[model samples]
Target: MNRRVLVPAAVLLSSLSFPLTITGASVALPDLTGDLNASPTAAQWVVTGYNLCFAAFLAFGGSLADLLGRRRLYAVGVSAFLLGSAWCAVAGDVGGLVAARLVAGVGAAIATATGQSSLASAFDGAARARVFGALGTVLGIGLAFGPTVSGFLVDLAGWRAVFWVPAVLAGLALLLCPALPPGRGSGQRVDWAGGALFTFGLGALIWVFVEAPVLGVAHPAVLAVVVAAVAGVAGFVRVERRAAAPMFDLALLGDRAFLGYALVAAAMMGLLVPLLVYLPSYFIDVVGVDPARAGLWMLVLTVPSVLLPGVGAALAKRSPRLLSTGAVLLASVGVVGLVGIGPDGAPWPALLLTGVGVGLTTGVVDGLALSSVPADRVGAAAGLFNTARLTAETVALAAAGSALTLLGGGQPDSGFTDALRVVVVVLGCAGVAAGLGAHALLRRVGR
Candidate 1:
């Protein structure tokens, strides 16, 4: 009805749709792969392509939103997402599906960057915190229930329903796009060189990780790509330092609290999200569970994500260091315990603990990260932080899929369980290290 209601509604709707699509699509993967006769890598691409493009382009999207106008970018993004979803719904093969997903990922990147910056610009002080908390809760709802809802959809309506649902939501958000504020973009020349270098480098890195297992790490091509990726990323940093209007503010990482929040976000993505993406498939292919039941079983792992962000927000205000460190440590511990579960063993106990830790940290980090930066650079801050998080998600997801495939000898059976255990152990160890690093940084900042 008004700017206030329309803005939040549009942003929140977009937020809800993104995670819904992510979780739902993961649940849809097994069915989709079976129907299309896709190879393991192709099936993984259905998710990885989307995340790779999203992570690679987020910096550009954020800078574009700041320069062109957030509302305009938001509209363009939603439109692209709608188009991509429609294409995905009609895709006839894995190649087509992965292509469509890449489009959707780009759109998602733009939508998220613009949507978050728009919200940050619209609210301040306590109101800003509360709105962000609500954002987290909504994200949790989408994530928590996505698998169960998608499982039923896959059973009743087929995996196509997953893409269709997001398309519909994107259309609704588009209708309310006019209510979004026309943000004042600094009319500066965009740093296209920096953007290109970052995208190329990040894309190269992810491709290497995804392909490494399939093509042994010693392969000449993989080695070449690794060298090129390093050079590209290193080149990006150098370009940014000299650019008149850089896409990202490299200096943001200089803030101890900001860096701390970022590490926490990275740990959340790198450690926890892979389980969400891969476990449903494990339940169905290995544990002999139906899709619907697998989705419901996921609730043990997701319910906390839905319930704990509010508590996390409260904790963040009083003791940010504890929240950052405790959240990661708790999840890491759960994951370590998870390594002991057999194929037939109960998973709920470990999942419950992981859920608590993930839930506690959910949406809280975004708000905390943004609050540390200057208001004028909110768009860049939001973009850069999310780039870090999604990059972690993309890399970790790819690595996990690669590990599963290699260890299982391309089968999702008992070998799959063993691989999953190994993967969990590695994630748990890394998460603990990240948690401690985050704690030290936040403590130094007295946050």
Candidate 2:
């Protein structure tokens, strides 16, 4: 097969595995929660742990790809993911599954980081946009069908099958790995200190949020961890400023268009991801639907995401700022509309609207973001932009999970609905602010 076909096939297949695991895990969470008798916090960690590792390791993974080789990193990542998934399939308890997920997340971070970098290395201009659009569409395919597939798997084979499926997908992706170009890296110094500080800092923040609901925020242990988290972040900033080669280009934040793209990317995921994570529970518990039916209802949201990225990319060519701002605003409005949902209320309209808004930013943001910067900074931009996205996703998941646990531990009651309302309103308001902020910055592009 042609290298062209092989490279994308490898990347896209691996991309499919990540979101499949992510969304499928959400569908399987209830089953796992019951089977293992895990606490709400512990159960949330099954998902959060994976995201935390993914977010934390992304910059480092990108750096390793640049230092070692994209193909090598990609191969290593996929292997680790396969192993992690296999471990998850056999895990007997929540702790074991969370540990395995963390390992898989690290591998996912490496593969995804290298996937974007490999594309950036191989393509330029319009071609790059198209490939990324294709990438986003594949991601949508994973997110779109993950739940339905997991539902069937769980119904027939059990929750463990969800993990097994991704493991098999990872194995298939590995076969096409050799088709990737093992291009020489630029030999940039890897910022070990910055990576550690950033990863630990974010992990601490998530820990605080997850535990605060159960253990009082004023608890001595929580207070100490909070202080440590703050210090870790501060230390990361300081190290990045002083490092000969920082993991992130701090100066990139000064670029208005780049900043706009980053904000849009973060907001897009913040609004969409929580729904992907928690909506299954809402359907099964609050709406009294079975897991399979809940997955079908999720199609209203995930289907638009699967279909809209290419459209968004094409529209972006005409007016990027318009697309970015409008898509975010649309999503924000859709989220606000979700506050009125009840067991009796029709959720399709609002979910579809939200999906459309979030979908439009899928491939568009990454392409716009990378193009906004100088060619030399494309790698750093990729790291920072993806880091921003995954960070937002992790934080949002933690916040939403904490809120739900606090409200009713996802009990099929009014409390869960009330908590859901609070989450959506906050997310909606914040998304609106981010959209307007991105628009303002994008409009001031030349200034």
Candidate 3:
């Protein structure tokens, strides 16, 4: 096999490490708490802090990749993640754990922001699409199996094993960074004000959500968070509109193709990842299953991860445009399945539909998001894409948390009806929008 072909493979393997770390850590949370003597509320911050940093910095991380060069930044990112993982392994308390998670999140953001951009640079036409499909499989596998993976490691060796794995993987990726492209920024200012506003706003919003279940909605902390997330997001948008060489070129919005593509991403990512995140929660918290057993029942979701990409790949090869549109619509159908299921039921079939929906959407989203971008702007596009999806995810998580609080939390069979209703309605709307978006992209691209 050609060494040139092997290069992208190497880059991808390195990229996989960060996402694995994310999922692994979440599953290990129960164990982490006992060792560190953390409160349930505080232990949740280990995940929240990573999310806070990751969501805020994604767009900026892309800018850094553009300004510095993907390879150099990749090395920096992977190395930082490794160090942070080690820091997490040895952290003495909640404060220290949160700090390590924050750092780890920054490093992970770099990987998330640049991985697709790097691949686009490495391949073209059909090959680029194929690479993304494979990337999707890696993503699906990592996400779907995170709890299981973390559960295994945590049970066998300990939760610390989860931290150890990423450190080693990141270290290896750092060693292989030399083969990537040299830096190619377009001489733009870094948009610090925009970054700060985004960071502060999102951070506040997340603080509100993660804390809300523990701190009642009436609590000052919750109120302040709600207020700040709104204000910060608005200020960031205003600043971005004024910035010279904005961190995210909102001008991409003017390109109807980019706009349509991004909205689809926002909705799909916003809905899909969180649905998966909370699925196990639904099983354990609602269905009254064992935590370990609840993870195995997720086999419904995990099995699709192994097989669906190949099916999606075949569809894309035949008609990338319509297939992406159609795949998006399938998510709506899945949402309906969830909404229609009874509170008296196990939701097994509904969850299976959700898995299929996720399978259909992931590959299609990957294709449309990357394929629609002009090659010259691949890095910028990737960065912007990551920002949009992360923003969507942040919103989804916040909404899910808020909705559950309002609905009176307990079993998916009981409390999740309203929550699932919200998920279905919003996701259904998102699906329609994404289908039309793909059609628009196809028309604009003259595919």
Candidate 4:
């Protein structure tokens, strides 16, 4: 009931909405394709556009919040997101839908950029941990619930309903901002030039990666995009080094522990997001389940993901290295189990373990990422963490599309095996790295 708690309470809603929309759309895309008259390639953009923009601008969003007032930006972002969702809900065609998704992504970046800073500005060590724990729970649940929730909405009301849910949440966040404390930023100059360069660079790179599957990696458009992306990055780096106040302080990467945490987050995302991306494909194509039914099965995988964080949060406080151990163990076991899955169809229990593993890793990873950085640098830490994770997310989603195209075996069984194997190997390696990271930080953050 305290306004202090109300801040994260409101912020958590925004965090929850991010993944819900991200994962929810994947499950609903099948229906969306038909209703919107979209092609397979265009459907990919529905998800890609959101993530591309989310990653491109998230760091800048954080800096902007620090420069501008958090309250002002939160209101701005939530309103924009709400308005975008309205557009998506009534979008008439694939082009309209993709554009709406891009708009929604911009809104999400605003909310995410400021959400953690607001929480940190409002709370301290132990309380911060608890709020973060709850945020983890919210994230896990949003992702876990997205498929099932979207499925129900799509089945009962239509795909448009999925867009409306997050829209309403954003609108409520806008209303609750008045109850929150005043923001601390003094409206410093935002690195618009730096932000523009980074946006163009990252966007171009993802554009190429996303199109590779459909366009052929060797296609002229793909090559051109890749070139533009590289040039964009070079330009961004040069620009940032000279900017009055760069959007991202590349110097932050000089902090070994901080960079390690960011990499782990990236690796964790690379490991899990891909698995989730491909699972829907298996449910629909291999299992021959309809979109609604496939979504239900996918939700089964996410249930543990939704709840494990609450447990992991408590454990993380008890042992700085505890979640790291569990992250490695769960991911290994889950991926190894997946390696044995065959064309006959996956066993239900194996599927469940995979989801459990995902939840375990995500929860612990989130906790460590924030805890490892200095208190004053939570903004940089949170921004770097989100950027790395979002990059992995964009990669994972695009890679699945690319992997399937290359490994084309005409069956979801073959596709699933191919995709899961790569993810399993990747996560297995990440688990080891996370363990090393925990060990390195064990003495640093000394219990």
TM-score of each: 0.94, 0.95, 0.80, 0.85
What do the candidate models score in CA lDDT, each in turn? 0.86, 0.88, 0.69, 0.72
Candidate 2 Cα outliers beyond 4 Å, as residue runs: 120-131, 184-187, 445-447
Q: Which ranking of candidates, highest lDDT first?
A: 2, 1, 4, 3
Report the Cα lDDT for candidate 1.
0.86
Tens-place lDDT digits, model 1, residues 40-152: 88888888888888888777777788789999999999898888888999999999999999999899889988887888788889988778777877887898999998898
Q: Where does candidate 3 clash, by residue pair?
A: 286-411, 343-413
| Candidate 3: tens digits of C-alpha lDDT, residues 138-183 | 7767777766766667667877888888788777777666766655
**TM-score of model 2 (CA atoms):** 0.95
Error of 4 at 142 (Å): 1.1
Task: After the best TM-score superposition of candidate 2, give how far the Cα of residue 416 lies from its true spot, in angstroms.
Answer: 1.4
lDDT score, candidate 4, position 342 = 52
Per-residue lDDT for 1-447 in model 2, tens only? 877777888888889999989988998888888999988889989989999999999889888887899989989999999999999999998999999999999999899888877876777789886787688778878989888888888888988999999999899999988888896777877999999999999999999989999998899989999999999999999999999989999889999999999999999899988988888878877787777877888888888777787788788888899999999999999998899888764467889889999888777788789999998988778778889989998999899899888886666688888989898989999999999999899995532
Score candidate 3 by lDDT.
Answer: 0.69
TM-score of 4: 0.85
Q: Which ten residues in a row have the lowest lDDT in candidate 1?
A: 340-349
Comparing 1 and 3 by lDDT, which wins? 1
lDDT of 3 at 124: 82
- Candidate 4 per-residue lDDT, tens place, 161-203, comes to 8888988888777778876666878868888888899889878
